[model samples]
Target chain A: MSDLNNGRYGIHGGQYVPETLMNEIHHLEECYEFYKNDKEFNDELESLLKEYAGRPSLLYYAEKMTKDLGGAKIYIKREDLNHTGSHKINNVLGQVLMAKKMGKTRVIAETGAGQHGVATATAAALLGLECEIFMGREDTERQKLNVYRMELLGAKVHAVTSGTQTLKDAVNETMREWVSRVHDTHYVLGSVMGPHPFPMIVRDFQSVISKEAREQILEKEGRLPLAVVACVGGGSNAMGMFYNFINDKEVKLIGCEAGGKGVDTFETAATMATGKLGIFHGMKSYFCQDDDGQIAPVYSISAGLDYPGVGPEHAYLRDSGRAEYVPITDDEAVEAFEYIAKTEGIICAIESAHAVAHVMKTAKNYSKDDIIIICLSGRGDKDVSAIAKYRGVDINE
Target chain B: MSRIKNAFENKKAFIGFLTAGDPSIEKTEEFIYKLIEGGADLIEIGIPFSDPIAEGPVIQSANIRSLSGGTRISHLFELVENVRKNTEIPLVFLTYINTVFKYGTEEFFKKCNESGIDGIIIPDLPFEEKAEIKESAEKYDVDIISLIAPTSEDRIKLIAKESQGFVYVVSSMGVTGMRSEIKTDLESIVESVRKYTDNPIAIGFGINSPEQAEKYSKLADGVIVGSAIVKIIEEHKEDSGKYLKEYAEKMKSAMKN
Candidate 1:
């Protein structure tokens, strides 16, 4: 059995859900422990990840961007190539399957940019479970197309109109819903955040990214890269990519956070930079909150990166100095989206563009032959409409 | 005796619940007196939180209304302190861990001690994680109540062994809401809890009408009705005191048998 104590990423994670849901959480934890290593479950999950969603997404070298920057050689691990068009599919497949194993007939999830919701809805439909997604009213409006796509996939969508009416509120509404129908329902929480087992399970599922990237990088470069970078929105993609590299003592791990206007201002979503240690959404992690302890509303041009609190493992890494988390403003992320579109001919999601922006911001310091790998977590199709509006070119929805 | 233990003396305790600062702080103070006058043995005052995962829509809306009315945790402390001047009824805060954590765990507990808080019910803080505030709560002589649900079948005895003040036996499986009927096997659960400790056990959650209060009082040491009373306040708003007085009196009379 997987040790329940292991879920705590060094004084970070714990089960903080209400008593009504504790039984379900404990049951899920037990199931996760049993099935995660069970042969039949692993084989099914592997086959789906590979034959279904196209596992081992390419780690392509961006030669032009490397040459143009005249610094470190950059390669992107293309999670965008996966079915559902984002890295969220990786964890969703494992969780939805586990929900089935647990005898849950209905599945629920919360989304910020609607990527996770779409991915959850996709997995639930394929698995033949009833699916309901809770998205903040504001997010449903921001990512209107994704909302349509989720409904198209046969998932009922609930517009959450709670505090701030954003990602935080969506999670609150989802948890409340999960509490109400816990006996037959499973909350397919997205990202490497939330209570015990979730952080551990998400990291384990997402670790596939790093596992494949590591083998490819070792095979191609013959050595590890100088630094590994990924954008941190609830830190799933970054945790997945960083998990396999934690023991590679010499490799620098960087997580780029959404600076919104700037970290100095209250509008930022740079949780690691400007937030304090607090409990929210079931984990004791860094959160952007006010003096009264209310979860503060956060913003980023990239809707996905607008969450106020970060994953507990990210908090542990920041404290241990194993990873460096820095802020990138909305303007920089937008510029990087355009830059990567032009330089690499790959339209990266605004969320992933934060990582690209980090590379551009610090490219001057690294040696010309230094190598860098960026976990390009999603495609920008969903972001294009938002990006267009940002540039004052209102695209008709 | 602790105020909580004293509340259960002789008759089955009738616990009343209210969201502090709902509608307004002044009205909340008035209702506290009215609830006690109408025979509330103990009071559970809920501090408004932006995200209350354990609450149903009724209580959730009450929290939002309270927060919007300019209520803060500090203000609630002040309200409790003001109420302490006139009464000695047991009072406990029903809130999330974040609310206490943000106030500094030790500082929050110490203030609770000063303001006459008998205990706290943090729905989000489970048995395994109670260690987060247990030390501070103990230091302040404040009991940190543990909740037991029907789903807590295997772990009931373990939780009951260490339950302070009382074991809040949740009669239903879901969030805090008024239920017309509670199907959980309370006698069996209470039977399990009895083997562990002699600390009084109280059944709460989904307890609405006097019938529920009477029904649950027979199964445990006490009965706690929250949503039903909060709904009364929700309906009456500023004039909730008079209605709550009648509701609490009715509930207390039902529990007397």
Candidate 2:
């Protein structure tokens, strides 16, 4: 166990919040402490992952894609096969179980693409807790299917209209709701952000991805991967895949951000590459803001990636030089989307396509013998129509 | 006499409230001087946070404006350090607990002491959860002022006993703002507080007019008018110091007359 009190990679984490919610955050922090050491908590979480979530998703060797690229060996960590069709299930399950153990009866969350909301609702339904999700009006419109899926899972969806009416506004609305109902409801934050314990707790839960990937890769291949790549939107999936590899100095961790047009364009979601420290949605992180501190509008082909701020941990990593962040242009991501479909028969989400695009460029630079593991975070099922529209083709046709 | 103690002995001790880094750091420093010159016996500098829940529209807007002016915890320390060069007005900090926690507890108190601040008023920190801070602040010689709301009688006594310096009696059960009429029970509340501690009771949260100041000055040891002064500064944004001086003189004269 690491002593976070000394600070994590020079990033200080603590409970910085209003007085009213201190007791609740403190209680959650204490619970995290107990669960960190308690065998029962770990055992229960492991059981849920194995039995319910279908854990240890396959590390498929994409030999065809590798041959097509004529470069390094590429393997995909199929997190898309997990419950709810994404790596988000890993965190939602852990948080929902923690909520249940705390005797909380109501769960609230914020979502952009609604994947986390659907997963949270799934967990709440399984545990018989009332669930509510706040999503930005813009996100609800863009990711209408996910919104419908959350409602279908019996979770109420609130269309947040404030701020940019995107993920940031959804986060603000959720925090406001959490403060008023701190006693009875638990706010199951989607990302590894927010005050103190949440970033730590969410990271701890999501770390199972890297923990399993390390063993699976080592067992299948004779040695460790040369690089690990994942898309960074609040960086939950990326953090999950990079946590175990952070100290492995030889292995490089790459995070792909959405370059809506280009880095110079205001319509990008590259927090680490170009953002300033500011407070938004209950946490201090790199935020895309204008000179006056007003949040600027963010654009991305994937609704999930349309956030102005990245996770504080990601900012810390970027600053400490532990992880390297790069932007994948929308055109490049679409090209990768088509390439993966044509070569590997895998249609990746535009968010995941950002990672795919990065892997393609990065693979060409490495030797043919080198290995790179790309986290295929989510399935393209939710993205098929959007991809078709972007390519000026209908899926039915 | 104790600096805070002496001020309360002769007349009601005035506690001036102004947002830190308001307009700008230079303007905030100038505002503080104007406040002290205007007969403010004590000063409460507000450290603006991004989300101020207890603040009404006026104070909330002020916070947003100040944050837009780049007022962070580090900036606040710099402001206080600079102000320490000129005056020693028993400056008390009024901020939420997050800002304190953000700058670690020990470091926060150390910086406060280094800046020559006398006390702190954190409305969010309840008595039960403040033992650690209370102990640390005692070591650092920084008095932690406690607030007693209108609802809690028994808790008020406990707060009065534990609290150092004067007790900040919230005049109403609302956020910081301005109002025309003084609440009727303000005198009774001040009288109730006097039973627990001989320390001065400062009534605040809506003392705008000099008449309200005069009325509170007659009943309580001090009258705090924040939004009124902030409004004056905002109204005369182009020449903040001049307007602040005029407003402070008006407030001080009303307290005396």
DockQ of each model vs. true complex: 0.75, 0.10
For model 2, residues A191-266, the per-residue Cα lDDT tens digits are 8887767888888888988898999989998789999999998889998999999888889989998888887998
How much lDDT does each candidate structure score?
Answer: 0.90, 0.79
**True-structure RMSD, every candidate:** 1.9, 7.2
TM-score of each: 0.97, 0.70
lDDT of 2 by residue, B117-198 (tens): 7888876566654753776788888888877766555566777877688888777645668877645477677777888887
Quick one: best DockQ, which candidate? 1
After superposition, the stretches of candidate 2 with alpha carbons farther than 4 Å from their true spots are: A1-3, A6-8, A277-285, A289-297, A385-397, B1-257
Off by over 4 Å in 1: A1-4
**Top TM-score hit:** 1
Predicted model with the maximum lDDT: 1
lDDT of 1: 0.90
